[model samples]
Target: MSVDEFCRFCHKNLKIKGVFSQSTKIFEKTSNAKTVFDRLIDLGLTLKRSPEKSIRTCRRCTSILSRIERDLPVFRKWEEEEKQSDSSEQASAPKAADQSNWDPPASKMPRRVLHKFWPNPPAPNQTRISMSARRSITEVMTHYPSSKTVCNVCHPDDAGIVNNISKKNWKTAAGLMMRHKDLVEEIKVKILELVQHECKTLCNPSQGFILWRSSPEDLKSFSFSSLESDLNRLSPFLLSIFSTATNHSLPSTCAAAAIAVRGREPRMSAFSYYLNSILLHGGARKAVFKKLSKMAITTTHCHAVGKLKEFPHTCGEGLQLLEVQKEVLPTSGADGLTDSAGQDDEGIDLGGAIGTHRQRDSQLKHDLVDSSGSQAGQMCQEKRQKRRQEQSTQEEEGAEWVSRKRLRSEVQPSPLRLVVDCSFDSLMMFKDVRKLHKQIQRCYAENRRTLHPVQFYLTSLGGQLKQNMDETDKGWVNWKDITIKTEHYHEVIPREELVYLTSDSPNVLTELDDTKAYVIGGLVDHNHHKGISFERAKELGIQHAQLPLESFVKMNSRKVLAVNHVFEIILAYMEMGDWQEAFFTVLSQRNGAVPVDQNGQAVEDKEDDDSDRESDGTNTVKDNTSSMPDQQEGANEQIEAK
Candidate 1:
């Protein structure tokens, strides 16, 4: 087909002599085959006759002839020698019986001469050799559907040659090597089927959008401005997709459908429409409406209405629509553009109408209605401007009103009181507790004098006294005025009862019971304090005067009395100037209270305490002894000597 073939008649017994003879022969033949051979000559497959004329031959076929040609390069000499031999033989030849019927004998010619002039036509199978040659080339190349093949027109490394081998061909080449030609074609068919199915399925408008959208090349070609216009115009597409879809896929479908239907209509501002719709239908569609309203409020609340004055045109339009119309426009005349004659088929003469209004005798009328249209339109334009000015004035007036209202609703007298009975050792740890007490006292004094919002009465346990806390003092807080009278035992009495009180006057007492209090042990050492039990207090024991620390409660769970004993040892060690040993002993809760005489003097009992006391060369202090103290001292000395 590509002109490597030839006609049977063209190659038959014809001795080619000159360029003219070949041309005349080719011109005589009328077969399609001859036409193909000429085309083959043009394509350089067949050889030319001489310098003056061109002929081309298939290089592969010519290569075969070249092998024979190499055996004899003296073709012109050989032809001339043969012609001379023929002329000499013919000139001396006797006339044959029938010259026309006589055929030449092969024996009469030399072997080279026989090989040269004798045409050995190929066998029947080899007759279609050109087709076979093409098939052989295709076979070697693994028969991929090449965009071009190696022919007379192009070479293997042709100008358009690319290294890109098809993925399909890669597999087919492997298949051909494995000798599985059928399997290769089957695989190719399946792959093609899948590709076609995918293309067809995704070819619709919505799916097509996704296909294009995802492709970088396609997206580069798509127009974003056009897409926005589409979204505006195809709002119904979005609505349809949104309404039909009720699951996770809705968003994608809506986007695709909207894109597919895009650019079909003029644009509407989405944010404005969304906000207005919410405000209008919020009562009916409560959830959706509320969401929109909340977003609107959030947006508007941060926007300074006063700043709207800077953009007079935008603000004015909003105000006119909202305030002037109260969001309800008259059906017919609201636009204010309808001529008095009304309903002109050719539309209103806007230019003429504006001209006529300009000729009016009043400047105020001109202000109300501009060259634009309608008083309504003009009012809308000025609404935002008016709102901003009004807002500024309103803010100033509101500030004065707020101040007067505050003066009238001054703080009322507080009748409730709080009190705390802190253990002395536990209360002394925090430096700020004293300051807090002074503040409470000052606040109480002020309340008594002026009768402010709050009143207080204060009391604390003065000394160590172990009294059972009554149920009233167990996690109970009083707020009533009648109970205030009954609980009043003293103006300020230390009854070993944890109490917080507020006084309206120096005379009126409010005893606060069961209030939470926090105790901070001494900063230097913390192992000593007998405050009320935090856990037991929670279960209605004595209400704790101090909030027990989590670390303390977790680290030490002994009885409050035992903790107090440890505290006593720490205090006595500090007094005795044995703070270093005390520090270690307190850290691990291994400290024990020092033995004391009846007069409450710490006495060294055994070897350990004595060793600590004598470690530092400071003499222990001695106190005057009474008769009872002398007896207690004698007994303490014997115990220490033990």
Candidate 2:
């Protein structure tokens, strides 16, 4: 009997307890019982007592009925007014008009108004059709047959569902099922596999992976205005596989599948669309460029944003002047006259005068030899001696000026010296080395931008680090105010003047010591070689110190910053004279750096509590370090591990 019973309201099986079948008992116990009873009456249930069968309702329906009972009265009044108006309108219609010619007035009730009365109304066929039309392109595409043949690796069930989808009026089928999330994921997997397979067939890894290249004639064909356009322009092989897996000929579906594959294996596709887009539309933010690089949408931030080609001409000119001084001063040594003559000849050649200077010198020497006995020859000899004396005096004066300039630069040096100790070259991978080179370039750019830039020394610059810089960034060597040396920092600068900056050091730098050269280890080990810099500093017996990061700010990540970031922070402090401002300015919010007071409380939190503390007449501060001893210890241990 219980198995046969069902809820009269929801039509669900009444297998559980708490069934409310008796109207008399329900009205007595439940609030808003009259509305519930009236609803049951509207459902055609009689109030007469019947022992054989009664209106059974499940617990879920009972709860819902009770909850909606309060709104039922308003709905009923509105419904009654609508019914009376409809009846009056029907009666007013012309009796002579044919019944077929008169169409019933459209329902005036809003969808929400109907929902209050019938919460779970059954969906009509037309509503279902409209909803299917409104579904996403991917969902709509699952019902269409693929233009290309399905891959052998495709699941049989997926293939069958795709095949069964009719080309015309698929909505007419009563038993057809749509693919769900699992099916979509399977399609994505199949697409990736096919892409890899195709790549294996067409690509050679040793030769490098370039999916497609646009020729001069085909440049117009490669438009990156939208994903659809990009998809339409994808390589024929990729397009075919993506369309087959997604079971649609639409460019959007193929593009989505290709994007999914690219996310998994970035190097599989050339991403010509994204690359071209970045190139054509430049000046994107650094974070945007970085995000694109991380997504593998672009190769590198510098390349994507065109920063690699921006050379500081002022710095280059200064370096060129210094180089000329060094070259000229060295040539003015013991064989000064001969070297001066050679240089004069070279200068004449460079000036497009070619053999004129050499011919004049030869003619003068021949005249001096031939007219040795004549008064004119004696006069010529005296004139030549006088000219030689004048030339020697001029050369001496020029050498003295160069020496004085060199002495002034050496005596003053820069107030602050920034040394990048690039000794850990063997520890870095190829990609890390590339990243280090980019950071070094940025450091140079930052230094050159300032009015009083510090002297930058890149020491121990050999091995792969040197090779990458030489190949990619040739301007580094000629950059002004920078010294690139292949020897160790100790060999270049005195050990007494060297003060290494490492994250693991116990000593915190309170101020910038201009007298001592601050050394930053030029190693990008990706946290693989933790404390290596500090250890090297200790072994070399150089004073090591770390930036006062713990006192000024709190980082969401480890305090270990990139080389350029550290350099920029130092430069910022030198200009602003405030460590906190420098940290905030140099460290991006993306790094999760939050400003904190000297007490280690966040600035925002401190500001909010300042008024409360002032009103209370108490300046007592809570010592969080004392409260969370265990946490602090754990953090210290973690830092040590890192």
Candidate 3:
């Protein structure tokens, strides 16, 4: 128990002297009333050799205890007066038998004597006291769990004190109010939980990372060097929490949990920011960040390899509020980290509360073989290097051979044109429809504006199209061989009328077959319309296939993607003939499906592609890049007139 809470109940004693003597006397004489010490012992608290310094007094005892030594201004004067009074009045005089048995009255002194020996020196009559908490912030936190209560006790000032705290001289009259409390490590943990919670909200949720206390001597332990090496390659949210002052802050004082957030640049080189907050130091907490270099820690996507690269600066307060909210109303990790305002507005891809352990394993693995042939391998490598050096030294070399391999590598064409279903134009909002028009126009221009390998056709377009999206003519459509029509998809094609693709579809398109036309819904639903194409495809009795988003990646947000994004994935897949490669190429770095660490090694997930097998017997396991080019030759095919 804190010093003020002597018995867990404040005795509110106006005056106190000889704290230990009075406590011992009360405990020794009490018969019916349980003493604070007795109560503490009965609670099975004395099992340890050392006392629980955090809790000292019991719930029922009256307090003769006072504030912390530093809190009392006239403590030296009070102790001196009591000592002088005891020496001059009582030491020389002998007590009578009746008086010896009688105990001195508690706090029964004249107003003048008490005023001179007041427990708390009277101040200019102020209604509310404005100072650091009477007890340490941690001590007060233990008593009151609410952030508001903790803030009130620790900061006292609501306006500016909580945010802008400067160090004061230790020897000054008011003493030091700021204490060293390191929240870096704790805040890092909370950020991960928040991001994990919101992973379901991002178009692509990335393999996230948390790095702490990195020393140059031990960079490998937390992958700090790896982070820097891949810093430029990273498309991620970088949030660093740092104190404006030099590394160490005041210790054992009221420290803030959530602080201000500013732009992030000096670290990850991303358009991110750092959050600054006060940390409260308790018993053993160093309060200062252990390493000066790591005084401010960061959390973000691991070794960015994909396109999704920005974290909105507006989401700062929302992320910090998450840490505060979960502590107040504790719940399961699945429960979103949010205030009463809701997680949608915050844009933090965080769902679920903190402290859930998501396993971390290397997605990339290589087997090591130790054998007697090591010496042979080393000699062979030396020989190769020597041969290369000797060749460079030579004046003349053999004539270079020119192979006709490029001429022989022919791309076989297939009549499998991909049709764009423009039927759901009205189902989406105006903004979404507009984005769809712009994206479609750009998608063709970037990939295949002239003699494109993949044939593009726009079908099921209604006549009442918007001005720019009109059926008559637009930039790419007017300039290129792009086909645009107002016929329903079923009326345009017969055999494989419509092979609709969507995110929520159950079937995974395993192979691309010739003579079958694949249809993509040309719609971008930013925040409106879901499952529209899927439901329409089902109603039309057409084959429905969702791009294997679930099979290839795990997204923080819904797997639903933009029209252009899906179209690009299809083109890359047709060229690469590998779902994993295409998914990685087209999806944002945030997609959780498979995460590559800083070394570009795949993080191993036991339940990933290896565990899953397609009916066609295609091994989903990733292989070396050298083998992919060979497969690309057979996979490359163009759609033509049947």
Candidate 4:
């Protein structure tokens, strides 16, 4: 039976109807209207009193409520046949007594046809991953299917169904790598042969060199299967293009490193394993991070690109774009976007200036002490001179005042010093080291794009790479814009002066004043090293500031985020001046965790998997290398030599 729905606010009976079912499954005749989050202000009962749980609409609140997806009603559409049969049964039935005998015939039908279409049975219930784990994966990447086993393309559990990777696709990627590698070597060798002075001339921030590598002919000629099959031999070339401009010449400026390649590989590879050894030896060299996805990142806003059918440049969000071939066209900076925002201020200032000039003219006519002669008197001339001098002086002072204010506001009293506390407890293990490397690489990338790149200090000096490191093997590659001191961060920055920005602290980072320099721990201890950062901070007596996460938005996942993700969030917040805006810009609706209000108690990480699929992009290390078999032989040997 249809029941009238009423808004608690207007108390008006809506067109919406609620067929009361013992089950939560929604019946027909409910209206879906736009819902708003009134931010828990005294905006009445339309929104709730608590900010987090306040997503209510006293009106027709259908699927309008967001963030909390489980709150949405499960609608079951009533079929036309069901309606007809019910009507016929009512007409044919004798009375209310016979109505018990008459069951709705259509109710026997299943809501969704199952088993008829060939497929496996419904999956059994799964143990939910912890919120911290969800967040770690979310931080470094866009959504990939739950790849529990090996890649479907590489070793398909089932034939005829590809899980986003194919053999031929690997061939294309490998082909591109080979061609790029060949071209780079050729260019560099040719330069060495021809020029004597500086081969560094090819180096640029925005290098516009596109190679038609991976063309139809090249793909056909190359043994892609062999390359894909034997990744160890092929990976070094990919690494060259991906991470460094060393062995291969990667253009300094590229929009994306788009890999419209087919094929899937495991998350852990020979690349990461070998990388771990290198770090253990020389200490983590140019830190590293990956992935295949459609990426549309403008300098301002990063979002999903529309369908490829509608727009051609929009390679699927899953496809990673190349660095040189950037995803976005250059647009005016934030200043241009808000040029009109300051219009009112300009208008007021202009009006004030005009009024002041009028007042000065009036004073000249009235405030003159003496004017005796018909032909312009000496007093009049003196008054005019005085007025002109005053006007000039006033204008000069106003200009100086504005310049001074702008300098104070824009110029830094002290530039924000960001630290990478690489000095973690020594026996931390392998996987965490890899994750830490990925974090470092990501921070470097984020800093490159920051409006004012932060001064990065990579502290905790001693390790393997430092032992026999040559003069040429040092400094961050192609990142002159950023001040990153590996081990040297302490030379300039005192350890005591550093304030840790970690989740361990209770102090929410509401504002960043010109005073304290912030530091992010370089260790990825998983949850195994929980509160290590906080403990370290406490022991050192360095003040700590946690990100204002719960204060700003509701999250389901754990508060801990990847190093680069945190840095980018801070940079985004600094640029936009809003925590919410910065959070949304970097974190997607699905992958990002939002916490709800819970009586000041410790917020539980619920078994919610709904938002796990949403992602901004792949957060994998851009080391330009993928993984290999975990126990690839000679891994130790290779690290020892390199």
lDDT of 1 by residue, 1-642 (tens): 222132222222122342222222322345544543453344334433433222333333334344544544465467678889988998899757776887765333346433432234356565333211211121123334765554443222221121223334565455343333345577778766754454344344553332224221232233334433444343433434344573524435434443333222112112222233234322222354345334332112111111111222232222221112111110111121111223222321112112232353243234334533766776887997877777778797774222212332463544433332233324343333333333333333333333232323333432221121222133223322212222222334333443211111122211222332212111111223232223323333222332111212122222122222223322333334454343334333322224334443444334446666767668553433354454444333320100
- The TM-score values for the models, in the order shown, are 0.18, 0.34, 0.29, 0.29
Candidate 4, residues 227-259, lDDT tens digits: the string is: 332322323343334335433333221211212
What Cα-based lDDT does every candidate model obtain?
Answer: 0.33, 0.58, 0.43, 0.42
lDDT of 4 at 130: 18
| lDDT, ranked from best to worst | 2, 3, 4, 1
Best by TM-score: 2
lDDT of 3 by residue, 47-129 (tens): 22223121233322333222322323375568578879977877689865576577664333334433322324435674533
Question: After superposition on all CA atoms, how large is the RMSD of candidate 3?
Answer: 27.7
The RMSD (Cα, Å) of candidate 4 is: 36.2
Return the TM-score for candidate 2, rounded to 2 decimals.
0.34
Q: Which ten residues in a row have the lowest lDDT in candidate 3?
A: 360-369
Better of 2 and 4 by TM-score: 2
lDDT of 1 at 554: 21
lDDT of candidate 4?
A: 0.42
